[model samples]
Target chain A: MSQLSGNTKWSVAKLKERSPVRWHERIGETSIFIISLASILLIMLMAIFILKEGLMVFINPSIRAEVNFRELFLKTVWQPISEVPKYSLLPLIAGTLKTSFVALLIALPLGMLAALFISECAPKWLSEFVKPTIELLAAIPSVVIGFFCLMKVASWLAHAYEIKWLHDALTPHRLNTLVGGIGISIAVVPITFTLCEEAFHGVPESYRAASIALGATKWQTALGVVIPTAMPGVIAAILLSFGRAWGETMIALMATGNAPLLDLNILHSVRTLAATVGAEMPEVVVGSSHYHVLFLIGTILLSISFTVNGLSQLAISSLRKKLTGG
Target chain B: MNANRRRFRLPKGSEASGLALTLLSAIATLIVLSMLAIILVDLGSGGYRKLSWEFLTKPPEQGMTGGGIFPAIFGTMFLVIIMTLMVMPVGVLTAIYLNEYAPKHALITRLIRTSISNLAGVPSIVYGMFGLSFFILFLGRRIDSLIGAELLFGQPCLLWAAATLSILTLPVAVTATEEALAAIPEELRLASYALGATKWQTIWRVVFPKAMGGILTGAILTVSRGAAEVAPLLFTGVAYYLPQLPLSPTSQFMHLGYHIYVMATQSPDVEATMPLQYATALVLLALTFLLNLIAILIRVRLRIIAGEV
Candidate 1:
């Protein structure tokens, strides 16, 4: 390889500058570079646009006069259309946290365990069938899943867990954080399982053998040795899934009752930043503060996802370093 | 330490614990699969009756409560096709650069990799906002001014929607194509070089053809994603109700996922629109499955060829 490059390097550089063939190759390289850099360009542009538009409510006195930065976040209500409008982001933030908490509580265990089983214990046939089956769930549009939750699961759960004494708990809408959380869990399970499964696969076989050689049982070897060794990857998977559940929109929008209320009640509905952006972006007037508030929510969502993704990347790199001894 | 103690505390019956975890995992897998099964069954049962020849070919009437979703389906196809055209070349080229051109661990290479990873992690709705402000409001308006048109390109339309979706699915295509390129052994490239072909010549003559199935699969997945995704389309170009088919890329259009959302949420009577929603969902699911099946087939064929080779 070095010899070939050594022979071609000098003349190739000259050829690249002048010859048509080399020029074509150079053009090809430049086009590929531009395309490869497209996402970076888009990411920068998106962050800037969202930040610029979203910060308008905070910086512009006219917009700030409508909604104070401190009060908009500190207060409980989110009546953007009220006689005295309030754009408190707290309710939305709390609701997002609650929904994501519930979703993670459900998905992490299910996804991780299923992934563990597929990678560690499941028979070949079982793994083959189950892996694709879980992945197929990923393909079903979130709206359809939301629709199912709204039409079927919400009512079913409401009836199944009805308490006559607490009649108001199950509102007429019958949609709540728990129902939406469960539906979103279904969406996130695929992501978590796929990632965790890959992580499990990354655990070196020698470690498992060493554990067993040291008289550890299959269960201990699998759980105690395997999971910890793959912990970085597994944790990254968990973090990323949490990000997904946080940013999930259609399910939350459809099945969360769309109430911008500040409550920790998992049984009741709440809104999220992503859902707020999707639900409200259309109705607001162009360049209005209401519009900027939605953009602000988008900006918040973007940063959160960015942070989670950055964390996941760090974890993966650390895990790679550990494996490679670099 | 509590963590060390927990790790050191070995349970007595190794076989029993292993069996217990096996059962638990099996149950979890079963639950996941059953959920998919139940959803497909529910959609099939609810929608099979609604879909007919007319349903596939006609536009809506009566506030979209009484007609087929031909326009939505058509617009979906239009959007997916355009997105495919826009994303495939760039995605394929980017993948080529990542796998073939760029050195292993250069700073620019690492930066690009990080950018790709973060881009993949960005939420879909965020892409919608970006598309609206950046593409429609910013670039679209600028293009309109340059072209001396009034609101022609400065609004949500098929072109902008497809463009937004192009960015959304770019990472998927790049990753898939990179995988395809990686799957081809280094020996193939060495052989081409020994035969006196230039780097580009070798890539064009040997590597790309071998990798075509995978590249096509990636491009097809991008199209499938265009069909399944709705949040990004919420603001870009999808009209809640567009009776007319989009005559041009500049025209706003209907989309299957958005149509389902509208029928389920916006109909005066949600109960009345339930059947239509089911049918639309079914069609969308079917298209997604069909695309996935093609990708799976290409992958299977690749595996077979690899085995033979």
Candidate 2:
């Protein structure tokens, strides 16, 4: 008993005199705060660098005075590599809008209805089986999708739409806005489906029960009440995916044949802003005017995506606030 | 009473209209599902022929027309592993700070969350540009000058490539880990505090173990997404045809997705290398799917166990 008491006393003295852990609490806290703070700083730095590089086009009086900002930015000519360099962003913006618009047109209805089916109509087992399978679509890389389209779908589309009944002598080619849009639709569908389903699921059970109780059929309740309640979120999903499709690089790079044509024709090839940067940035000389122009394209891509993403995020949060009556 | 009765009663022909609309929605669902089915079936048949032992083990022969994708595979694996290591710690720590330490509803918290979400939405090409301009050009050039080396870090290499990818995937890792940390019950932390543990001690002892599955899922997701990405690699470190595996972090490496892109678009004979392209796509797809499946299995198992807990 005396020996045990002596041992305990000695250990207590040692414990009180010397701390066991290597790091003091304040030291650990400061390091963690710094680590977390560094991530935010890094993100800020990257954004600023891209913006600064892009702003060079506007900041350089030589280029701005030589080139009309509006005409260079809004016109159709984009030949930077030639002897007479005219960098117009119109065609790329037009291509982005055309492809993303087409993709949303195909995806929105299909994804909305799929979401409706999954949330309201399908049985427990089928809904369970389908959601994961559809989400697996999101796992498919854009590059693989582009490759598949380039080799198989493009040729198939060219032949499939090789009919004169479409009223144009210019036929659909293997690489066109239509094929790129279709490839992008495959990627967009999963995103729209996932978000739309969440919106639909978020519609309260009481709303559904009350609608059905008031003698509305299941379909009527879903189409009228549930969808209307979830409409904001659903629209946000579409805009979010619009941003996705617009910003997608690999699919457009590979499948669209990268023809920078300033036309509204879906059957003709179009090169997107993202595709232009991906294809042209590598060969460009460092610190050259061409490189700065590519950065301008990146800036354009960033702003469009940022605007779309911000709008969707705003829409979603407001919807959440309204729905929660906060 | 009569109005109420009428409102409760089904109007004539309503059921038929409802059935028709339901049918339309179901058909839309079928169309989307069918596309998935078709793509998988098409890729399966097309890529299956090129999945041979020699194909996986040997380097490209005949101008990348007949050789296996061993070098590309090896490079991709190295890139993803290094990227995962680089990203996982930073991401998890950020997530931990957000979920555990940060004061809720604070301006700093909101700012951090918004920036993190915004980071995820930035396009791959933009990230590629950032890596090239800032990382390789600015940072790498400065390092080269300081070290008296000739264009060592100022050019495309595995280091800048992995670093760029780590940034690209930061959002995925943080989001997943945040979700994981949020999944831990508040009572667990309270209980640790009741038992005389410090906040740091509680985090290390109580929260981390419970959140391991979620953090792992996020890590796997980041790795899969990073591994398959080719655009950012186009300028960062990917070689046109360096079949000899990347010897070091500063060395250029061939990538599977880039290999497929090269084969698809720039090959002298596109038709001949088309099979190899599909095969490469298949391997990339398989790798992505396999990682996702592992993450899913881990998540489902954790959920079941968590349910009991």
Model 1: share of real contacts kept: 0.62
Writing each residue's lDDT as its tens digit, candidate 1 over A144-231 gives: 8988888788878878556665666644447888888998998999999999999988989999999888778877888888888889
For residues B115-165, could you state the per-residue lDDT of candidate 1 as single tens digits? 788878888999999999999999999999999998999999999999999
lDDT of 2 by residue, B16-69 (tens): 988888898899999999987888888889999989999999999998889799
Candidate 2: regions farther than 4 A off: A1-23, B1-12
Candidate 2 accuracy as TM-score:
0.94
Fill in the DockQ of model 1.
0.63
Give interface RMSD for all predictions. Answer: 1.6, 1.6
- The CAPRI category of model 2 is medium
Give each model's whole-structure lDDT. Answer: 0.86, 0.87
> What does candidate 2's lDDT look like per residue over A222-316, in tens digits?
88899899888998898888888888999999988788888888989999999999999889887666677789888888887778888988988
